[model samples]
Every structure is written in C-alpha cells, then in structure tokens.
Target: MARRALLSEAWWQQATIIPDNEREIAKHYTLDRSDLELIMRQNKAANRLGLACVLATLRYPGRPLADGEVLPAGVLRFLARQIGAPWESLQYYPLRDFWRDGKQMISA
Candidate 1:
C-alpha cells in the first residue's frame, strides 16, 4: 500500500487560491481547457481534487517532492476514483505526515 502524505498549511493556503490561479495551474499541468471545464462540472469534490492536483504539480515541478509539500498519492487515487478519472494521470507525492493531526477529511 502507498504511504499517506500530509499537506502543509502553506500548501493548503496556496490551494485555497486555486480559483484565482486556475489559468496558471492548468497551463502548468498542460490540462486542456475543455477537460478542466468537464472536471469542474463533475462535482464539488472532483473539482477540488482536480484543482488540488494541478496546484500540487505547479508547487512541486520536479521529483523528490519536499516534505509536506505534496498531496498523498492515496488521496489522489481516491479522489480520482471518486471522480471516475484515471489515477495514473496525476503526479502527487506519497504519504509522509498527517494533515492537521488527522482532523482533515483528506487525511481520513
């Protein structure tokens, strides 16, 4: 099983601004505009996770993601499965720390 990774408050803060950074994040991920629109239309959870993936990728471009700097692969996989997306499409970090000491939904 893949280990669980935690997202830092700083990363969460950055993710919260996804609406304002949509274009940039999408561009960085090479996401097609139509596909982005489709994801947005899926549901709130899917939209959030999709945006989170894009933001995470933009935050950590290369390999060896920094501590608490990337979303857990398990979390990404779960979200992708929930939204009917392929898990292999996203590049997220593996488990490391717990988000908010396990209070966060993503950590559960």
Candidate 2:
C-alpha cells in the first residue's frame, strides 16, 4: 500500500543522519515500522488471493465460469491457465466475498 521499499537506504543511517554524510539517506528518505507492516500485509493479501484463484481454477476444470458467472480479464486468464482451463473463458477482476448470500462481487 505504501511505497516504503528502500533497499538502497543504509541500515545504520539513523544515528548518523544530517550531521553525518554516511546517514544522509535517512534525511532524504524515511522508513519506519508501520511502512514495513503495510508492505507485509499487502504481500500477504496478494499471495492469498493468487493462491485462491489457483485453487478455484483447479476445482473447476474445462469450464472457466463457475455457473452464470463471468470473469473480467487479467487474473481470470492467469488462473485458468494455471489450472489447464480455456483462457478465453476466463476473466480477471476484483472480487469481494459477501456473507449474506455466499456470493462474490465481481467488478467490470
């Protein structure tokens, strides 16, 4: 969510900031624990969704559509290919799980 990826920054730049040229990077860029946490959560969610799409495709072979459902584009094709389904029948879009009807909200 937050662009806090600073592999270029120094590990010991904090103590030597401003006055010390060695820690000059710390002045230019700031990274904290919360930034790291956001990155981690985003990575986890992405990995989980990717895995879920794969599993869904595997569960339903040949037919990319679950029932009367239609998938958008990108992710669908990827998952379909992952599970040996027809890419043409696949769709990729954002989906949200709804508890009320056990349904998914697919975006167009």
For candidate 1, write residues 1-108 as lDDT tens digits.
996659888986665442224345344444455645655663345344556465445544533334555455554554465455666644322221223333643652
Instruction: Report the Cα RMSD per candidate.
Output: 14.4, 18.8
> Which structure among the candidates has the greatest TM-score?
1
Clashing pairs in 2: 71-91, 73-92, 76-91, 76-92
Candidate 2 is scored at a TM of 0.21
TM-score of each: 0.27, 0.21
How many backbone clashes are present in model 2? Answer: 4
Model 1 superposed RMSD (Cα): 14.4
User: What C-alpha lDDT do the candidate models reach, one value each?
Assistant: 0.49, 0.38
Residue 68 C-alpha lDDT in model 2: 52
Ten-residue region with minimum lDDT total, candidate 1: 91-100
Identify the candidate with maximal lDDT: 1
